[model samples]
Each structure stands twice: as structure tokens, then as C-alpha cells.
Target chain A: MKIIVCIKQVPDPEHAKMDAKSGTVVREGVELMINPFDLYAVEEGLRLKEKMRGEVVAISMGPPQAEEALREVIGMGVDQCILLTSRDFAGADTWATSYTLAKACQKIGDYDVIICGKQAIDGDTAQVGPGIAAQLGIPQITFVRKIDEISEKNIKAERLVEGGYEVISSPLPILITVVKEINEPRLPTLKGRLNAKKAEIAHWGPEEIAADKDKIGINGSPTKVDEIFTPDLSKDGKIFNIEQLDAAAEEIVKKQKEMGLI
Target chain B: MGIKVIKEKCTGCGICFKVCQYGAITMAEKVHTLENGKEVKRLAVIDLGKCTLCSECVKPCPTSAIELKAEAHKFEGKENYKDVMVFAEQRRDEFEEAAFELVGKGRELADKLGVNLYALILGKDLKGKGEKLISYGADKVIAISDDSLFNFLPEPYTNILIRIIKKYKPSIFLAPSTTQGRALLSRAAGKIYTGLTADCTGLDVDSSGNLLQTRPAFGGSIKARILTPNMRPQMATVRPKVFKPLDRDPNRKGEIIEEKVPADLLKSTTKFEKWIEDTTSAISIEDADIIISGGRGLGCSDNFKILFELAEILGGAVGASRPTVDEGWIPYSHQVGQTGKTVGPKMYIAVGISGAIQHLEGMRSSDFIIAINKDPDAPIFKVADVGIVGDLFEVVPLLKEKLKRAING
Candidate 1:
């Protein structure tokens, strides 16, 4: 089995803070980590590789710092890592990003399966995987929680839905975006770390992947931000720093009662 | 600099830093003593490597501190595009609530743009579903039935959508940003070489007649107004519960066109084996008058019992923040956030939830929000109509007792 995993670097959601004066999120000391969802993709890829005795390659499309995300995956036993970086690729939405990745896959030209996280935590848009499948004209099964069977030619998986799950099967060269419930990702090993350190990450640009200049970057992205702003909740609600919890509780009950809400 | 932060105007408010999904902007501290012996902080710094020139940090800056190079381009042929088309998603003959919401929103936008509101329902045995959409405000409902579309397969769905889009040339296309919506729309947009904004919280037509799609990004820290300026079908997606469905009007007059898609276009490479629907508890937060949601501060899954007990007394449903669901304290169905569900209740009570931006996006639409947490400065306080800075372990039980007595009496 030849596996390709698409991962991303996102701000850690754990270490969140608010600016005291402005009440905005403080971005300082906000470290970047692998998109929590992508860890499952890497884990699933490695697990498949381990079972099938094949290689898994990791790919990330972001700035140079995104190399750290690729390195992390390599340290988790991804056989190869590739960083799809270019000035033109900046501001690319899922459309162009998926296209570029599909082109890279064509450049690699030998892959039985591709994997990605169900959604990037930062964007939470589960579009790129299906977009890539569309760009490559291949089938894609998204929101997969469990893989029941797999081989070089075909695979079966359970997809998460509103009520429960659905069983779906697809031929090889198909793409899949997995949910966190798929597997528990393993930590990087000592040997994996050494291998990652010596591994040469192939940096591919549009030309390197034979991508069209018109379809590789912001120019290729159809969506544009007409405006941007914070989601300011300016409702002047009341705040009670309760010195006496029991009394405040009673007061709240009385207040709701007066308002006819109780 | 892909994007520059002007130091003279920046107040170090950190809004830009938070809104940036790429983690490109970081605060740079430079303290200087003023004549009054007070210190002032410097502005944020942009990292060229990480900045994608998405211009996310440019406008939200109160001081207008950020600037970026503008791209120059020209477009034509969009003048021929007309009307607003919404994909009225359905499954097993039942239309999703989002379908009606989109139709309602689409009707509003179409009226504003002086065009028609068209809805496309693709499912097997969906003969009369289009009428429901018409009652909800669709000017014309296009019903296309096929066994292949009985269950959503992206390839076939996209093919049929592309065919309809090419034929009708709608100025705008809208759908819910759900599992099938995102998968099908993105793939269709890609094949048709158009744009599709995902999970839009707001959609409207500008004075210039462009679909202004607003959405939360960067873990819901900030909102972006997106535009497919030149695309024929300016497409966008919204999550469930973002917009309210208009009251059904059976007397409303509309046309329902039963359409047929080519068999060749309905080919799917993936095979669907079977669907297993889990029997879910009959706890609906959408219709609930009051929702008492818990978070990580509850300590353990066992702590959720406190919220449940309080909810039971209050005649409300139980809700959980994403962390609680992710931690397995509660199921994902009870989770309220961008990824889980968007809800609007009469009153939302947040207990032990130090709200993340994602969590805030879900419940901020409630009529009245009361937050109870030990952390006085939790983001949940920002949106709460009533913020109580107290430990939930102490305040919840007391509040529950008082409310129960007051209600029963």
C-alpha cells in the first residue's frame, strides 16, 4: 500500500487567553501545533503502512513553518515528507489547495490511497479532501471513523452520520478524510526521531508539480474576502461577581421570577 | 512584508493575532515610559512565512494598523447570471431543516436582488417535498429523482448540480455546510471552477449585487466577509440553525418543475453497503426553552450528573461544550459548537464552561445567555446576558434549589 497523508499546522486550541483590556484573544505565546484532527490521518496512514508493509508520505500546504508539522508526521514514521510551498500558493482556498495537492500526487504518480483529516481545526471546513478527489477525478469517503478492511486494490470503512454510521467501499486511489474516532495516534519513537532528522523533505512548487500557473495560488482561488472583522458580541449583559453565592442565587431566582421567566 | 502592521496605529489589542487562522501574527512587546511615567505597549508583528495574504488581520484592527498589497484583476460575463438557487437537501424523503432555512434566506436575497428564488431537491421518492420548500418561500422548486441520489454520493450529486447550474445560470447557489453539503458543493465548485465559501453565518446581497457571505474563521475568533466576485453561481454554505426557516404558507403560489438528469452523469465510483442509524435519546436542544450546558470545569464525566439534575428541575435539556464531547464525558449529539451543532434557544445556561471561540459561535444566538464559571474573565462572559463569577459546584445547586422552589410555588 502506498499512502499519502495531508496534514496542517494550526494554533493550539488548549492554550487560549483573552486580552484584559480589549477582551480579545491574546495571540502572544499562542504556540502552533499539528491540527488535532490531522493526527488521526497520520496515525491511520502509518497503521495501514505497518500492516501492509508499504510506505506513507506526508504532505502539508502552508508556509515554511508548516514544515514543522510535516517533520512531526515524519517523526511518527511517515516514510517521506513534502512541503508544498510557494508565494503564489499563498491565499489559496480549498479549491486551489486541493488542486495543488492532486497535482503533487500526479507528480508522484504512484499512490493507492490518500488521507486527510475530516477538517482542519482552525478553518473547520471539510472541503479539501473531496475537492482533491474531484480534482483528481477519484472517489472519496469522508468522516470515516473506522476502517473495517483494506488492501492495495480496495478498502471499506464506516462513515459517521447524523444518527449513526454507514458502511462504504471504494477502489484504490480513493481519498479519505478521517475523524478522531478512527484511531489513537502513537507518539514519535527514538528511531523515528533519528530518521526524521536525516530525512530530506522535498519542497515542491507549482512548477515542480507541473501545476498550472493560473490554478496554483490566489489567482486559482475563486473566493475572496471582501471584508474581515471580529464577531463582537456587544450586548451589555449584567455581570455579578458574587460575594455571596447563596444570596446571588436567590436574587437571580427573584429576578427571573419578576421577568416572568421562572 | 506580505502584510504589514503599522506600529504607530497599533494598540496591541491582539484582535488581529486572534483572527489569524494561519498563526502568522504575534504580539511584539516594546515598552516605553511616557512623560507621566506610564508604560505603553507596542503592536503585533507579522511573520511573512506564515502569512498567506488572506488579509484576515487587516480590517479587524481598531487602529487600522495592518496593510497589504492589493491584487488587480478584471472579470466579465457575470452580468448574464440571474436568480438565486438553493440546494434543498433531503434524505429518505424528509427535507433537512437547513433546506428551508436556505430557501428562506434565498427568498430574502432574491427579493433584494430583484430575481427569483429556486430550490433543487435531489432524492428518491421526493415527489411532494418541493411543495414544502415552495411554502417556505421558493419561487420554483426543481425536483430531480433518481435512485443514485437516494443516498448522497458526491460524484453524481456534483454532476447533476453542474448540469443544472449550467442550464439555469443562477447568480448565487446556497446550501447547508453539513457533511453532504460541504462534500458535494466543494467538489461541484471545483469541477465547475467556481468558489464556495464554507459554513457562512451570514449571507446577503450587497448593493452591487454580490453575495456577501460572512463566516467565523480561526477557531471562530473572527468573521470574514467572502465574495465570489466574478463567478456565475456565487456559491456559499451555511451550517444548520444559522438562519430560521420562514413560516410555511400553503397559500403561497409557486412552480414545481420535476426534472431528470442524464444516467451517464449519475455514475458513482464508491459503493454504499448499508446504513446503521443509532437509536438516539429524545433530547432536542433546538426546540428546548432552556439549555444547561457543561464544560471541562465539571472535572469528570460523573460531574455531568450535576448539570442533568439541574436541567431536570429547570425543565430544560442538557448541552455540552465540544471539549466535554471530545473527552467522552458526553456524546457528540449533546455538543454545541461550530463542528457539532448550531443552536438557538430562549435561554442558554453555561456552567463550568470557559468558552472557546468555537463554543461561543454555537450558542451566542440564544435569546438570553447566563454563564456561571469560576473564571470571571472566561470568553463565555463576553456573550452572556448574565455572568456569575462563582464556582459551579456551589452556585449551581443553590440556583437549582431556588429556581425549583420558585417555579413550583
Candidate 2:
């Protein structure tokens, strides 16, 4: 079994700041790291690889700098790394990006499963994984929390719903977008880092993948961002400090009663 | 972008023609001569000039023959579209509260736009349940009933929705930003080639008729207003609990249009295995009217019992901060933060929580907030309507006892 894990390099959301005047995220000074959720996907792929005795290939599509993200995943135990990058791939929405990645998957044939993070922190759309599955014409199970069982032909997994979860089973050649609850990602070892430093990273572009020129980037995206502006947040509320716990409890009860909550 | 049809794979399903809101694709009879001298039929051809490149016809193509080709083209606005439509999400044969909330909001927007408010309900044997939407301010209810729709599958749901949007051409489409809604609406929007704003905190229609979608961005540091002025049937997924449902009116009468699900569109790649209903006593923090949450300050997993007890007495749900969940003190499902669930309870009690920005992002919209922490300088106090500067171990037990006695009385 060959497990393909899709990862992305995102500006550390903690340090990500919004430009109040422009209403756009200012990511220049922020550090870039593997999207926190993708780490779990990579870790799950490695674990599946260890059990299935197959190779784990980590793939990413972003700027040239994103190769470092793929390398880091390789350092964490992936066998290979592939970076899909090109000037033409810039500014693509989830649809176009998934189309390009799906085309890449088709080029990298004979994969049993493809794993992706549930959503990217910056975009938070959570649409790319399912979009890729749609483009590949394969079954998709999103928000997967656990892989209960897996075989060469079929796999069963637990998917997170609103309040609980559902067990879904799909045939082989399926795509699953996983949440952080799946597994704890492991840190890179010294030997793994050494291998990662020397490993060759493959790069693919639209031409290499035989992708349609019109469907690989911004042009292929159906929706366009018309404008972005900051929302007004002007509300005032009073905060009271309480010294006595018993009195505060009685006061809260009275307040609830006054508010008709009781 | 231009829509392309792969001739060899086209099945002439006519789904594309039916789903194309722009009338770009038209069925033309063409005879194809095979090498064996047999005549065959051809599929609908897309006129690039009229194609808005929304790709609405791509997903329902049974043969997967239609592809949206990337090209430098701008989508033209459609003037014929009218009314506001809300996707009334249902789970386990019942409507989610968010569904009613969307309808309520949709009604307001529709009135502002001077159009009818419509609700689209899809499920198995929906029967008379759709009439409930009318009381919630839906001027018309379009119900699509099919056994396959009982459990939400993205493909079939998107296909049916695309069919409806193409046929009705609603100007605005709203859905709950819950798990199922996010999944279904995103795919449906992508298929219909429309812009979708997810997890919207506020939605309003501008005087110019553009939907103003405001959502938290940059880890909830800022709210960004998004506009998809170029697309028809502008789409947005509103967060649950952001709006209150309209009061039910038993006397309210509305039109109900029942549509049959196409048999061919029912074939889905994914299969339903089993729905493991949440049997745990745990309540969805999002739906909880009152929430009592703890953070790393609780020190130990055992300390959660007191918080749970307080929540139980208050008829509330217990939530945890990111650190507590990361420490394995509680499940991630109970986490409240930017990466976890966003909740807006009527009253939120933050015990021992330092109020990280991410944590505050989830619950800042709560009606009223109370904070209890040992450190008076904890940021949680800033957002709290009431602050108790003390040890939680001492204060929590006292409050719990008081609440238990008050409830018993």
C-alpha cells in the first residue's frame, strides 16, 4: 500500500495579524510551519506505512518555500517528498488547487489512499480535500477521527459529526480528510533529519503532469474575492469583581432571575 | 474559465442543461459515426460566450465529461435571480436549530431585497415536517425527499441543490456552518461555480444587492467582510447560534413544492456504514445555553469533576480550553477555541481559564460571561461580565453548593 499525505505550509496562525486598514492578513514576519492538522495526516500515513509495509510520500503544493514543509515531513519518517510548485499555480482557490493536486495524484499513479488535513488554518474552507476527491472520482470521508480497520480493498474509519461520530467504510482508492483527533504526530529523530537533509525532492508542474493550462490556477477558479474589509466591533459590557464567593453566587442567582433565565 | 465537454465520455444525461443557470449549455443533436459504422448520439455543447465558468454542471455529469477549463474570464451577474434560499439542515430525521436560524435570517434579508424567503429541505420521507419552516418565516418551502438523502452524502445533496438553484435561481443561499452544512454547502457552491463565505458571523444585503458576509479571520483577531458581487446565488454558511429563530406562527400559510430526486443522481461513490449516535451524557457545547469551562489552571484531570458538577447543577455543558484538551484531561470535542468549536451560550462561566485570544474567540459572543481565577490579571476578566478574583477550588465548590441548594428550593 502506498499512502500519500497532503501537507501545506501556513503562516503560524498565532502570529498572523490582520492589517486593519487593508483588511488582509499580514504574514510577512510570521514564521511558516507545517499546518498543524497536516502533521497528523503525515503521522497517520507513517503509522499506516509501518503496519502495511509500504512507502509514505508526503506531497505539498505551494510556493518554492513549501519544499521545506515537505522536507520536514520527510524528516518525520516519510519515505519521499514531492513539491508541486509553479508561478502558474499561484492565486488558485480551493477548486483549482484541488484540481491541480488531483491531476498530480493521477500522474503519481497506483496509490491506495490519499490523506489530507480537514482544513487549512488560513483558508479554513475545508473544501480542498473533498474537491480533490471529487476531481479524482473517488470516495471521500472527511473529518475522520480514527481508522478502525484497513485492508487492501476496503477501509473503515470513524468520522466526526456534530455531537458524536459515525463509522464509515469505503472501498480502496479513497481520500480521507482527517482532523487532529486522529493521532499524535511524532517528532523528527536525528537519523531522520540526516536522511531528510540528503533526500532528493521531486518537483512537478502543469506540463509535467499533463494538466490543462486553463484549469491549473487562478483562471480555473470559479469564485473571485471581490473585496475584504474589517468589521466594526463597538460594544460595551460591564464587569464586576466579587470578593465573597457565597454572596457572588447569590448575586448570580438573582441576576439569572432578573434576566428570566431561571 | 470555460466549460469543456469531453465528447468521448459524454452520456447526454441532460443534467448539465438542466443545471446551467446561465443557459450556456444547450443540447444539440449530433450523429457520430463509429468505426463499425454505427450511429451514436452526442452530448450538450457549452457556448463559451455565455458560460460564466461557475462549473455548476460538472459534478452532476454522470459520465464526468464536463470540465471547467481555466481561462481569463469574469463572471457576469445574472439579473433574473430573485429571492433568498436557506438550506434547512437536518440530522437523524430532525431539523437542526441552525436551520431555523438561517430561515429567520433569510426572511429578514428577503424582506430587505423585496423577494420571497424560501427554505430547501432535503431528507427521507420528510412528510409534513417542512410546514414548520413556513412558521419560521419561510415564504415557500421546497422539499426534496429521497431515502438516499436521509444520511447526508455530499454528491447527491450537491446534485439536488444545484438542480434547485439552476431551476429557481435564488439570489442568496444560506446554510448553517455546522459539520454537515459546511461539507454540503461548500461542495454545492463549488459545483455551482458560486462564491461561498464560510462560518459567517454576520450577513446582510447591501443596498446594491451584494451579500455582505462578515466572518472572523486571523484566528478571530479581526472580522472580515467578504463580498461575491459577481456571482449569482451568492452563498454563505452562517455559524450556528448567531441568529435567533423566528417565533412559530401556526396560522402562517405558505406554498410547499415537493421535488422528486432523479434516480440517476442517486448513485454516490461513498457508502453509508452506520451512524453512531452520541449516547454520551456530553452535550454539544455549541447548543448549550450555559457553559462552564476550565483551563490549565485546574491543575489536574480530577479537578474537572467539580466543574462538571457545577455544569450538571446549572443544566449546562462543560467545556475545556486548548491546553486542558492538549494535556489529555478531556476530549478534543470539548475544546473551545479557534481550532475547536465556537460557542455562544447565554451565560459562560470561565473557571481558572486565563482567556487566551483563541479561547476568547470562541465564546466572546456569549450573552453574559463570568470569570473566576486566582490571578486577578487573567485576560478572561476583560471579556467577563463578572470577575471573581480568588482560588477556583474554594470558589467553585461554594458556587456549586449554592446553585444546588437554589435549584432544590
Candidate 3:
């Protein structure tokens, strides 16, 4: 079985700064990491590859430096790494992003399973993984915390829901978005790190993937953010407190009654 | 514009039919011949002119077949509504502080926009609380008495709200971004097909009455400013603790418009399984004076034991990074980040967390944060009020013992 793991390099938001004047993210002097969630996808792919004895390819779409993210995955024992880097892919929302990623997946044809993080940390819409599944015309599950079984013909998984869990089975070549509950990713050993240093990353672009230009960037995205501004901190925040737990709780309940909050 | 249902995809689940308030959809049969020359049964539907396009049908579809295609930028009309009203939420026979806080914030925008401030209170025998809402500066109180509304359910509440909103035509509607508020408002707004900004951190009014709603976007990396340009009752949901509640005065008085929940609308299609009491009352990381959190860098579950020890020393609750929860070292309920709880304690100590964007989204609002890690360049330090660049294995135990000594002394 062939497995493809899709990852993206995003600004380490902790160090990331937004340009006040332009209202855009400033990437300068900021560190980049494989999207934290995507690391789990890569690790899951590597784990499946080891059990099933197949090639694992790490695919990412970003600027040229995104190769670093894919190579780091290679260091974790992935068989190969693929970079879908291009200037044309900037400012893409979830819809356009899934389109480009599906194109890349198609270009790296004949995959049994595709894995992605439930959502990128940057977007948090949690839409892209399912979007890709929709675009590819495949069954998809989101918030998958555990993979119960994987075989040549089918994959059984447990999905996390608000109150309980859903154990569902799907046909092979399905796309899955994994939450942090999937599996703990292993660190690169000394030998694995050495292998990653010599491994060559394959770069693919819009031309290589033959992606539809219209559906590949901001142009393909239907949702546009009209305006962005800071919320004013003007609420009346009076801290109502007194001594005694029962009294405090009672006072709070009284206030709630007064406000019709109960 | 009218919404068209894809008949082939409709599962005859009656979800859309039951959810529709305007009685727009009805079951009809369409004949079709298969490749084997067989006739099949399929559900048919109709689009109603009064359909609000509130995307409620899209979620309950078991097959995930319903598609909601929205036309962009429908907000294009003169301002007709007046005042900003918040459905001040109540929990367990008490008013939530977040409600008055919304009223206080709405009061400022209402004054600026030259409109009255209205608070909608729905509860059983909660007239006393209705009086306090006006004292918090609500110019008008729309109190509806109903025993069913004692605990929140979608049916009569949404129907009543829709009726009141249509009658008054308030310019803006605000709801607390709590679980109940989010559930009701989302369905109600989606039913109306109006734009709503969720988890808003800030709100304001322009000279022309457009509600300027600010919320964290791009996964809390940046703040996104949103506006409902064409929609009436421009809606937003603000998170609790993000805003301050107001001071009340007994002398303040406002007219109370007592309304009744329409009996017909009380027949709800959804059922409530159980009322999950606010677990925060028992214990909450946000209310803790001091908080200790563990991140992935802790290396193992054995390491997290130190975190529990530290939290015990501080008399605080132990929190975990998103990764630690995934590692099964902790439960997801204790996870702290954008997807988890937003906490602001006096002291927040992050142990071994690298501080990803999602992680920061939840806790960036904390007052004083201290980050400890082995890596000097860990991103946790960026937001940490005090950065201790060292091995958490060595640093956590040492700090826990020291804190224990100080507390004992």
C-alpha cells in the first residue's frame, strides 16, 4: 500500500507578528514549523508504512522553504518527500487550498490512503481536510482520534464526538483528518537524521501538477474577508466578590436572577 | 434568492422539513429509471420565498449530503432597525455575568448609535432578575415568562426571539458565546441566513450603525474584523471573561414588555439528552489563582507527574498542552489552547510547551504567564511574562519543591 501524508509549513504563531500598516502577517524573523497537527498525520503515515511495508511520501504546499518541513518528516523515517511549492498558491482559503492539495495528490497518483491534520493551526476552520475529501469525491471523517484497524481493503476508525465516540468503517483510499489523539510522533534517531540529510526532496509546482489556475489561489476561494479590525475593550467589568464560598455563590446566583440569566 | 434542495441527495430524514419555520419544504416523489430499468423512490422538495437561508439543515444530515451555497455580500440596504439587544443568558436560576457585560458594551454602542439598549430575559418566575437588567443600563426590558425556558431549549426560544426581533427590528443582536448561546444563535441566524461573528473579543458601532465585530481569525494568529453589511439584527457572540460586567443601580427603571412563547412553536424537533451543569463550578483552571500546564516537551507521562506535584503545591489545577492530551498523558478536557478553554489567571506557568498558534489562541488572554523549557528558542517565551530557558525536567521539580517550602514556611 502507498501512503501520502500532506503537511504545511506555517508561521510559528507564537513568534509571528502581524504588520499593523498592511494588515498582513509578517514572516520576517519568524520561525516556521510543520503545522503541529500535520506532524501527527506524517507520523501516522510512517507508522502505517512500517506495518504494511510501503513507501511514504510527505507532501506540502508552501514557499520554497517548505521543503524544510518535508525533509524533517523524512528524518522521521519517511521513504520520500515531495514539495508542492509555488508563488501562485499564496492567500488561498480552505476551498482553494483543498483544490491545490487534491491536484498534488492526483499528480502523485495511486495512493491507498491520504492523511491530513483535522485543521491547520493558522486557519482553525477545520474545513480544509473535509474540503479535500469533498473535492476528491472520497469518504472522509474528521476528528478521528484512533485508527482501530487498517487493511488492504478497508480501514476501521473511532471518531471523537461531543458526548461519545463513533466507530465507523470505510473503504480503502479514504481521506482522514486526525486529531491529536491519533498517535504520538517519534523523534528522528541518529541514523534517521543522517538519512534525511542526504535525501533529496522532489519539488512540484502548478505546472507539474497541471493545477487549474483559477481554482488554485485567492481567485478560487469564494469566501473573502471584507474588513479586519480590533475589538474595542469597552465593557463594564465589575468584579462582584465577597468572603465565604456559599455567600459568593449565592451572591452570584442573586445577580444572575437580577439579570434574568438563570 | 431561494434555496434549492438536491432531491437525489435528500434522505427523507425530515430534518430540513422539521427545522423549516416558514413551512417551505414538503415531501414529494420523483420517478426515475435506473440502468436496469427500475423505478426508485426519492424525496422531493420546494424552495420557499420566505426561507431565511440560515444553513441549519446542512449539519443534521447523517449522510453529509446537504450543501449550503451562499451568495456573497448580500448586505446592501438602508439601516432600518434600532438599538442593540443581547439575550442575557441565565444559568441555574441566575443571570450570567457575561449577559450584563454584553448589555454594558451594547449600551455604549447604543448611545453612540442613538438607539435604546434592550435586554431580552426569558425564564420562569425570574421577574426580579428582569428588574436588575434595566439597572445595568438596559433602556428597555423584554421579559418573557415561561417555565419551559427555565432550561434552554431551541424550540420556543428561537421562535419567540424571531418574533420579538421582527417586531422591534433591533439593529444589533449579541449573545454570550457559551455552549447554549452558541447552539441557539447559530441555528437561529442560519435559519435567517444572516452573518454572525462568533467568539467576538470586541464590538463597536460606526456613525452609520454598522456593528464592528472583532474576533481572532487565522487561528488566533490575527484578529479579523467582521461586518454584516446587508443583514438586519447584525449578530455577534462574545466570549465570557473577555468583557467586564457592569455596575448595577436599583433606582434605574425601564419598561418591561412581558411576552409569551407561542404554544405552536414550543413543539421542538430536537431533544435534550441531559443538562450538563457548568463543570467550572466544581473546578476551573480560569478561576485558579495559579495554573500549571504541561506541554509535549515533557517527553513522557512520568514527567507530567511533576506537573501534578507543582499544581498541588500551588493549590491549582493542572492543565496540558494539546499534544500532551493526544499522548494520552492527560484528558482533552484539561487541554489548554484555542480549541480548549481560555483562561486568565494571576499566574500561568507553561511547562515544556513550545506554544503553537492553536495553543496560544486559548490562553493568550492570561494575566501573567511564565514559560519553562529546555530550548532557549521555544516559542512559549514569546508570550511568557517571565521566561525561564532551561530543562523543564530539572526546573519543574526544583520549582515545585521551592514553592512547597515557601508555602509550608
Best by TM-score: 1
| Tens digit per residue, CA lDDT, model 2, B267-329 | 776778888856444677867888999999899999998888888888888999999999999
Model 3: fnat (fraction of native contacts):
0.09
| Model 1 lDDT tens row, B193-295 | 8888998988888888889888877655567788888766888888676678899999889999988877899888888888876543334565466789999
Best by lDDT: 1
Q: State the displacement of the C-alpha of residue A93, model 2, in Å, after optimal TM-score superposition.
A: 3.2
| Decoy 3 TM-score against native | 0.54
Going through the candidates in order, state the TM-score of chain A alone for each one: 0.88, 0.89, 0.86
Candidate 3 residue lDDT tens string, B1-409: 2246654566667656654423445666667544566565665364543333334455556665555443444344436677789988876457877788888888888889888999998877775877788888898889887666675654466777788888888889999876556545644564454555667777887777788887775445456666666567787788666666678888987888887766886644333333333232134564455668999888887777787777765666778887887678876657777545555555677888987756766676665566777776665666665666666676666555545554455
Model 1 residue pairs with clashes = none
Alpha-carbon DockQ of candidate 3:
0.05
Q: Candidate 1 or 2, higher TM-score?
A: 1
Give the range where candidate 2 chain B is weakest over 10 consecutive residues by summed lDDT. B48-57
Instruction: Order the numbered candidates by DockQ, best leading.
Output: 1, 2, 3
- Candidate 2 ranges with C-alpha deviation above 4 Å: A14-28, A210-242, A246-261, B1-72, B401-409
Better of 2 and 3 by TM-score: 2
- lDDT per model vs. reference: 0.81, 0.79, 0.67
